[model samples]
Target chain A: MRLFKRQNNVLPGFGLTLGFTIFYLSVIVLIPLSALVFRTSGLTWGEFVTTVTAPRVLASYKVTFGSAMIAALINSVFGVLVAWVLVRYRFPGRRIVDALVDLPFALPTAVAGITLATIYSPNGWVGRFLEPHGIKVAFTPVGIVLAMTFIGLPFVVRTVQPVIEEIEIELEEAASCLGANRWQTLQLVIFPMLLPSILTGFALSFARAVGEYGSIIFIAGNMPMVSEITPLLIITKLEQFDYRGATAIACVMLLTSFSMLLVINLLQKWSRRYAD
Target chain B: MSAPVTSIPTSNGSKKRTQTEPAAVRWLLISIALVFLTLFLALPLFAVFTQAFEKGLTVHLEALKEPDTLSSIKLTLITAAVTVPLNLFFGVTAAWAIAKFSFPGKNLLITLIDLPFSVSPVISGLIYVLIFGLQGWLGPWLQAHDIRIVFAVPGIILATIFVTFPFVARELIPLMEAQGKEEEEAALVLGASGLQTFFRVTLPNVKWGIIYGVILCNARAMGEFGAVSVVSGHIRGMTNTVPLHVEILYNEYNYTAAFAVASLLAFLALITLAVKTVAEWKVRQQLDNN
Candidate 1:
C-alpha cells in the first residue's frame, strides 16, 4: 500500500525501539502465553474435554463465573454511585474518599483476602452485627462475591467517573424542559450516555474477578466443589503435578476470556456509535 | 426555575449543584458514598493495622524482625527494584515506537502488551513454569545446566514484569500520541542527536505520565501475589515474598504476625496511593495549564 511511504522521520531509533518492543513482548508475554495453548494442544480431544469438564473443574467454573458476574453487577451499581458522588457532589473528605477508591489496586490480594476474611467472619466487626440476623458472608459464595466486588470497584468507578464529568448540565436541562422529571431525566438522558462505559467497566470487573486467586482462596473456604474458584483449581492441579490438566484448564480460561473481551470490545465500538 | 423551587434552601447547599441535583438528593448521595466507602474501603485497611497492633507494638515489631519476614521484605525490594526499571525501559521504548510511527499491527502490539492484565495472574506465573519448571520445556536443559528460573528470584521477576508490562507503555502511548512528533521533528531539524532529542523533548513532555506509570508498576510489582505464588514454590526465607509470608503466618494461626507483615504492604499501598494522588494532581495541573 505504501509505494512511497512518507519520510517525515523525527530523531532516529524507530527501528531500535520497535525491534526492542517486539523482542521484549515476544519473550515475556506472547511466547509464555502461547506455550500454554501449545501444551494444551498435546492433549487428545477426549482428554481436553474431560480435563476441562471434570465435575470439580466444572464446579469451579460455575463458582468463578457466577460470583464474578454477581460481583460485577453489584459494582456496576455502587461504582456508578461513587462516580456520581465524586463528579457531582463535593463533600468534606472527598479527596480522601476519592483516593481510597484505589486502595484495592495497591493492596496485595493476599492481604485483602485475609483482612476481609477476618472482618466478615462471624466474629468480625461487621459480621457481629449481621450474624444475629443470619446473614453470613465469609467463606461462602457471598464472600467470594464481596471480595470480587471490592477489587472490581476501582475499575467501574475510574472508567465511569470521567464519562460522568464529561456529561453536560445543558443536556439535563434540555431533558427537564421536555417534561421529564429528575428521575426520568437521569434515566432517559444521563444513563444512556453512560451505558457504554458502565458496560465496559462491568466487563472489566467481571474479567478480573474470573481470574482472581490470591484474594478469593482465603475467604473462599476452598471447599472443592462448593466455593473453589478456577484459578485455585488450576493451582491445585499444578501442586498435584498435573501439568497437562493445569495447562488444559488454563487454556480454556485464556480462550474464553479473550473471546469474551473481544466481543465486549466490538460491542463497545458499536455502542459508541450512539454517542455521536 | 432558579427562584427557589419548592422551598429548597439555598443557604446550606453550594450553588454548584443547584442546576443538576437537589440539595436533599445531594446529601443522600454523599451519605451513601461515605458509608459504602467506610464499609468496603476504610475498614479493611483499618483491620490490617488494628490487627497488626492487637497484641501490642512490641509483638508486631518482633514479627517484622523475624528472619523469614525480613528476608521476604528484602526479596520483595529486590524484585521491585529489578522489575520496575526493566519494565520502564520496555514501556518507554514501546511508547516511542507506537506513538511516533503509524505501522500495521500497532493495535495488536498494544493489546499484546496488555495480555497479562486480562490473563489470570495464576496463568501468568503458570506460563513461565510451563517454559522453565522441572517438567517444563526447558526444565531438563535448565536442570542439566543448574539454572533455576522458575521457583526462584528470576521467576518472581519475570512474573512481576509480565503483570506490569502495560503500565508505563499504556500511560505514555496516549500521552505521546497527544503530544505528537512535532516537537521531536523540530529537535531533529535543529541537528540534535536522537537520544538528545528524546531526553530534551519527548521525555520532558511525558515525565509526569512516566512517573505515574512507574509508580503504579512498582506498586503492582511489589503487591503481585497470585502470579508470583504460582511460580515461587513458597520456600521460606528464600522465595516466600512478603505476601506469601503473610499467608504462612496466617496459616500457622499467628494472626498478629500475619497482620504485622501485611501492615508493611498496607503501608506501601498507602504511600503508593499518596504519591499517585500527587502525580495525578500534577497531571491535572499540567492539563489545565495547557
Candidate 2:
C-alpha cells in the first residue's frame, strides 16, 4: 500500500501541472525560439558566416554591444546615485522626483524617439544652442547612446532603489565610527553590499538597450554601416524577404546575448555566496 | 559662542564644514538631476503640445475633427478595452497558479511568463507572423477556415497580448506571494466552492495589483508600435493605429497632423500615469491599514 501510494502520489499529482507548464511554454516561447534556430539551420556554414560577419553586420555588432555596454555602465553609476538620494533623503518634491523615474516606463518608445529626435535636432531647442558649439547630436552615434541611456536608466534606477532602501544606515555609521573616511566607507562598506544588485541592473539594462528598436530608429537615423543597429538590420532583411539572412544574423545575436546573460547570472550567484 | 570661536580647534571646524558640504553637494546633485529631467523629459513632452498647436490652435482643432483621427482614437480605445480585460484574467489566474501552488516546473513557468519582458517587441510580433502569416505553420489551416489574422485586427490583438502578457502577472505574483495562502485556505475550509472563494476572497485581495497591471498593459497596448507596424500592413483607414497613423502622417510630411496624433497618444499615456498613481496610492493605503 505504501509503495503504491508513493508511486501514485508525490506532491499531489505533479504530472498534471508539469504537463500544463511544458505545454504552455512550448507553445509560447520554446517553440518560437526553436523555429528561429530551425530557420537559420537551412543555411550552409559558409553562407551563415558570410551573412553574419559582413562589414556592415560587424559595424552594427560593434555599435549595438558597444553602445549598450557604455549606456549600461553609465546607468549603473548614475542609477546608484539617484537611488541613494531617493532612499537616504527626505526632501521637498521627493514624491515628484520619484514619480519621474517611472516616466520612461510609461512613455511610448516611439513617442520617446520622436521627442528625443526633435529635442536634439539641429534646429530644435537644445540642439540650436549646442549646434553653435559644433556639437552634433541628432543622427549621430552619440544620439543612439543618449536614447539608450534614456530608456535603460529607469531599469537600473528601479532595480537598485528598493535595494538601497532596504540597506541599514547603521552599517555606514559603524564604518565611520571605525575611523573610515567617507570615501573609504562608501567604497569598502556600502558598495560591496550593493554590487551584485547593481551588476544585475546593469545586465538587465544592457540587454534592454541592445534590443531596443522603436526609441532608437528615429534617433539613430538608420544610416547603414554607421548608426544602423542589428534590430534595424533584421527589419530591413525581413522587408527585403531575406528570411534566411535575417535568421542567420538573429541566431548570432541570440547566441551572444544568451551567453552574456548566463555570465551575468553566474556572477550574481557568486556575489550572493560572497555576501553570505 | 565667543569662547567657542577660540576654543574650537581648526580640525573640528573643518569637520563641521565638511559635514555641511554633503548637504550642499546633495542640493547641487538634486538640482542637476532635476534640470536634466526637466529638459529631457518635461520639455520634449511640452514641445509635443506646442508643435501640435503651433500652426494655429485651429489647425490642430480641425485635425482632431477629422473622422480618420477620431476613428483611430476609437480603435485604440476599443483595443485597449478588449485586451486589458483578457490579460487581466490570464495574468491573475497564472499568478495564482504559480504563487499559491507548489507545482512542478513552477519556476520555469515563472521565467516563461517573463520571457515577453526580455524579448524585443519586434520579435514578439514576428513570432505571431511566423505562426499566422501566409507562410506560417497555421496559415493553411487558418486559411481553410477563412480566418484572417495577418494584416488584420486579430493580428494586432495577438501582438499586444504577447508584449503585455507579463505585466499583470508580474505585478500579481509578488503581491500574492506576500499575502500568502492562509486566507484562501480558511475560505476553502469554510465550505466555499473554488469559484466562490476566488471571487469572494482572492479577487478582493488582488484587485489593486490587477488594476495597476491593467493600466500598465493598456498604456503599452495603446502605444505599441514595432509589433503592430509589422502586421498592420499600413492600411491607412482600416488598420492604422494611432502610433502607426502618426508615422504615416510623418512619412507624408504632414508634420502638423503627425504631432497632433502623437499628442493624442501622449495624452493617453498621461492618463495611464494618473491611474497608476492612484492605484499605487491605494496599494500603499491598504498596506498601511493591514
Candidate 3:
C-alpha cells in the first residue's frame, strides 16, 4: 500500500510543496510538541499521577474548565442573537458593530488582560459602579469567566453568521404560511437549523477559553485552589524549575484540548454531511 | 449602508403577522446587540486610550519614548518581521499543496497544520523550552556552543512563529480550494511555466486572502503574550516584547506607561481591522465578478 500517492492532476510541485509543508510542520510544531510527551515519560506513573492530580492542580482544572464552559455558554446565546441582528436587521452602524466583533480576535491577549483588569478593578470605571453593589469582578473566578468570554466572543458570531445568512427564507416562509407565529417559527424552524453551528461555535469557544492564559491571569488574582488556571499552574511549575511537574500538567491540557478539537472536527464533518 | 427594510407582506390580522418582527421588537434586538458590543468590546478599548492619556499627552509620549518601551517595540517589530514572511511562504506552499491537489492523508495534513491553534499558547512556548531550555533536548549542545534560545530573542521569535503558524494557511486554503485549479491548468496549456502560472494566475486570485492572512498573522505575532512571556525571561530591554513590557510596567504599578504601550497595540489592532475589512470587501468583489 502506497502512502502519499498523488492523482494525475496537472499541478506541478506537489512533491516540493508537500515535502516543505511536512518539514516545516515537523520542525515548528510536531517535534516540539512531542517533547512534552518525552519529558513527561521520564516520570514514574505514580509520580505523574500525583503531579497532575494534586489538589492545587485539580482545583486549577476546575477553575479553568468551569469558567470556559460558562463563558462558552454565554457566548452561544448572545452570539446567536448577535448573528441574528447582524444578518436580519437593518440598523445604523451595523457594519461597525460587525467589525467590532472581531476586536477580540485582533486585540492582543495581554492588552485585553490589562485593559480588563483596569476596567474591572474596584476603583476603575465599570468596576466602581459594581463595587457599590458589593460585586467584585477583578481578581476572582468571575473575573476569569469575564476574560474568557472576551477571548472567546468572536468564535460563535463568526461561525454562526454565515450559517444564518445561508438559511433559506423559504423555510421560514413555509412555517409562517402554516399559521406559525414569529416566536414559533423561530423556535421550530430557525433554531433547529442553527443547532449544529451553535454547537460548533460553543465547542470552539470552549476550547479557546480553556487554553487562554494572558487575559485571565491579570484578573484571576492568582489565588491557587480558587482562581489560578491550569496554564498558570504550568507557568508556576516552570518558574520553579519543575520541568517534570510542568510537562505533566501541560500534557494533560494538551491531550484534553486535542481531543476536544478532534471532536469539533468530527462535529463539523457531521454537520456538513447533515447539511448535504 | 441603508438597505431598505422589507417587511414580508401579510394580511393585517391579529392572528397572522408578517415575516419581519414588529418595529418595537426589531429595535429591541438591535439595541441588545449594540449595547452588548458597547459594553464588552467597545468599553475596554475606550479604557485603553483613556488610561493612556490620563497623565496628559506629554507624559504619554514620554512613556512611549522610554528606552525600555522603545526596545520592546523594536523587538515586536523584529519578531513580526521574521515570523510573517516565513509563515507567508509556508502558507502559500501549504495551501498550494492541500488546496490544489488530491493526495493521500490530505485531511490529516490539514489537521497537522492546524495543530498549533488548539494548543495552549503557554504550551506552545513550553514545547520549545523543552527543546532549548537548559535541561532540554538541545540545551547541552546550545550551552556548549554558548548559544541562548529559551530566554532570548530567538525563543521569543520561535514562540510567536508557533502561535501564528496557522493563520495564513487557514485563511488561504478554503479560498484556493474554492478557486479550483482550472485557471492554472489554462495558464499551463498556454505554455506558462509552473512559476509563471502561479505568479500570473493563482497569486492574483488569492491576493486578498493572502493580505488578510498576513494582517491577522502580523497582529498576533506582535501581540502574542502567553507564549512569548514564557520564553522571554523578562529581560527588560532584551527579550521583552511589547505585550510582555506592558505586563512588566503594569506589574510595577506604572499604569500610565503600561497603557501607553498597550494603546499603541490597540491602535495596531484597529488598523488591522480596517485593512482586514477592506481586504474582505475586495475578496467579495472578486467573487461577485467571477
Candidate 4:
C-alpha cells in the first residue's frame, strides 16, 4: 500500500468552502477576538489583579451576576407557565400572544430599558400604584431584576415551548391511570422530561441577562456599588481611557460566560439523549 | 407525539382545545399568560406609542425630523445596510464549510464563531478598541496612517457586525445539515461545476433559511447599542446610532422625542417580527408539501 493513500471524499466544495470559512472567520471573528486576549496579555499579573479586583468592579459583578440569577430563576418558573399555556390551550389572539413573547428579542434593549423605567418609575403607571403602597421598583435592584426578566423571558419560553410540544400526553394519561393527581403527574412525569429544557432556558436567560447593559442601565439608576453592572463599569473604564482595566474586567466576563456556555451545551446533549 | 394522531392535529385551532385539563385550571393558566404578557410586553409597547405622542402628532413628527435624530436614523440604516450583507456573506461561507464538510477542529471552529453571542456587547466593542484604539497594538500604526476607527462610523459598523455575526450561520447550519449532501452530490456527479451546483441547487433549497437569517441579522445590526456606544464616543449627529440617540434624548429629558425615536426602533422590531412570522409560516408550508 502507498504510504499516503489519497482518499476521495464525495462532497464537493470542501477546499473552496473551507478556505473562505477560515479566512472569513479569521478576519471578522477569530482575529478580532484574539486581539482582545492579546491586548489583555500586555498587563502584568499585579496590574491585572488590581484592575479586576477594584472595589467598584467587584461590586458591579455582584449586582450583575446576582440580579441575573434572580431574574433567570424567575423566568425559569414563569416562562414555563407561559410556554405551557401557549402549547396546551387555544384562545383568541393566540398568534399575537405567541408573537408578543419575542418582544424582548426584537425590541432594542435601550428602548426596553427606558420604557420599563418609565412605567416602573414612581410617577408612572405601575409605579404609581406601587408608590402609595410603600413599594418602589425603579432605580432599585428590583428594577434590574425586572429588566433582566423582561429581556430573559424569551430565552426560556422559546426553549421550553418546543419541548412542551414534543411532550407526549400519553405519559401524563398513563400516570393518571396509575392514580397520580395532576400535580403529582406534572411533578414526576412531566417535570423530569422538562427539567433539562428548563435548565437550558435558565442558562440562556442568565447568559443574556448577565451581559445586559442597555436595558438595565436606564432602569438600574447606575448608582456606584449598588445598581452598577459589570458591563456598565467596563464602559466606564473605557471612557476614562483605562484600557487595561477595561480589558481585564471584560476578560473576567468572557471567561465566566464561556464556562456557562459549556454547561449549557452539555445540558443540551443530555436532553437530546434523554429525549431519544 | 406518541399521542393519538387521529385524536387531534397539533398547533393552533386544532380539536385539541381544552385537552382533558379542567376548565378552572385552563382558565387560570390563560389568565396568568395574559396578565404576564400584558404587564411585560403590551404595557411597554403601549407606553412607547403613548409617550411618543404625548405632546401630539406634530411634536412627534418634529422629533423625527430633528437634524440629529435624522442623522441617527440615517446612521442606523447605513450600519445595518453594511453589517447585514457583510455578515450574510460570512455566515453563508461558514455554514457551507461547517455543514458540508468533515474537518479537523470543526467543533472548535463553530464554538469560536459562536463566541460573540455570549460576549457582552460592551466587551464586543471594547475588544475592537483594544485592537485599534490609542495605545492599542495597532493604535500607533493606525494613528501614523491617520486612519480613524474607534470613534467613527467604521467602528460602529464593526461592533454591529461582531454582535450579529452568528445569525445567518446559526439559521443556515442546522437547515443545511438536515438537508444533507445528497442533492449537492447528485448535481456534481451530473457534471455541474461546483459554483453552478451551489447557485442552482443548494441556494434554492436554503433560500428561506437565508432570508430568515438576513432578517435576524438586520434586526440585531440596527438595534445594537452597548458595543456601538463604547466605540461611538456619543458624538451627536456624527456617529450616534438610533439606540444611542434614544439614550441621548432621554438623558436630556427630551421625553417626547426620546420615545418618538424609540418608536422608530420599535417600528423596525415590529416589521422584523411580522416578516419573521410570515417567513415561518411559509417554511412550515414548504415542509408540509415536501
Those runs of model 1 whose alpha carbons end farther than 4 Å from true positions after fitting are: A1-6, B1-18
Model 4 lDDT, residue A70, Cα: 97
Encode model 3's per-residue lDDT on B1-290: one tens digit a residue. 32323343332435544676887888898888888888899999999999999999999999999999999999999999999999999999999999998889999999999999999999999999999999999999999999999999999999999999999999999999888898998888778889999999999999999999999999999999999999999999999999999999999999999999999999999999999999999987887667
Candidate 2 lDDT over residue span A1-276, tens digit each: 363366532112234444554565566567876777777787899999999999999999998889899989988888887887766655678777777777777888878888788889999888899999999889998889888888888788887776665556566667777888777887897788888889888998998898888888888888988999998887788788786777788788777667656765676676568555
CAPRI category for model 1: medium
- In CAPRI terms, model 3 is classed as medium
User: Candidate 3: what's its TM-score on chain B?
Assistant: 0.94
Candidate 3 interface RMSD to the true structure: 3.5
Error of 2 at A93 (Å): 1.8
Model 4's DockQ?
0.59
- lDDT at B99 for candidate 2? 71
> Cα miss at A3, model 2 (Å)?
20
Candidate 1's displacement at residue B70, Å, is: 0.9
By summed lDDT, which 10 consecutive residues of candidate 3 chain A come out lowest?
A: A1-10
The candidates, ranked best first by TM-score, are 3, 1, 4, 2
DockQ sort, best first: 3, 4, 1, 2
TM-score of chain A of 1: 0.95
What residue pairs are clashing in model 2? Answer: none
DockQ winner, 3 or 4: 3
**Tens digits of per-residue lDDT for model 4 on B172-267?**
888888788888888877878878988999898888888888988888898999999999989999999999999999999999999999999898
Compared with the true structure, the alpha-carbon lDDT of candidate 1 equals 0.89
TM-score of each: 0.95, 0.89, 0.96, 0.95
Shift of residue A197 alpha carbon in model 2, Å: 1.8
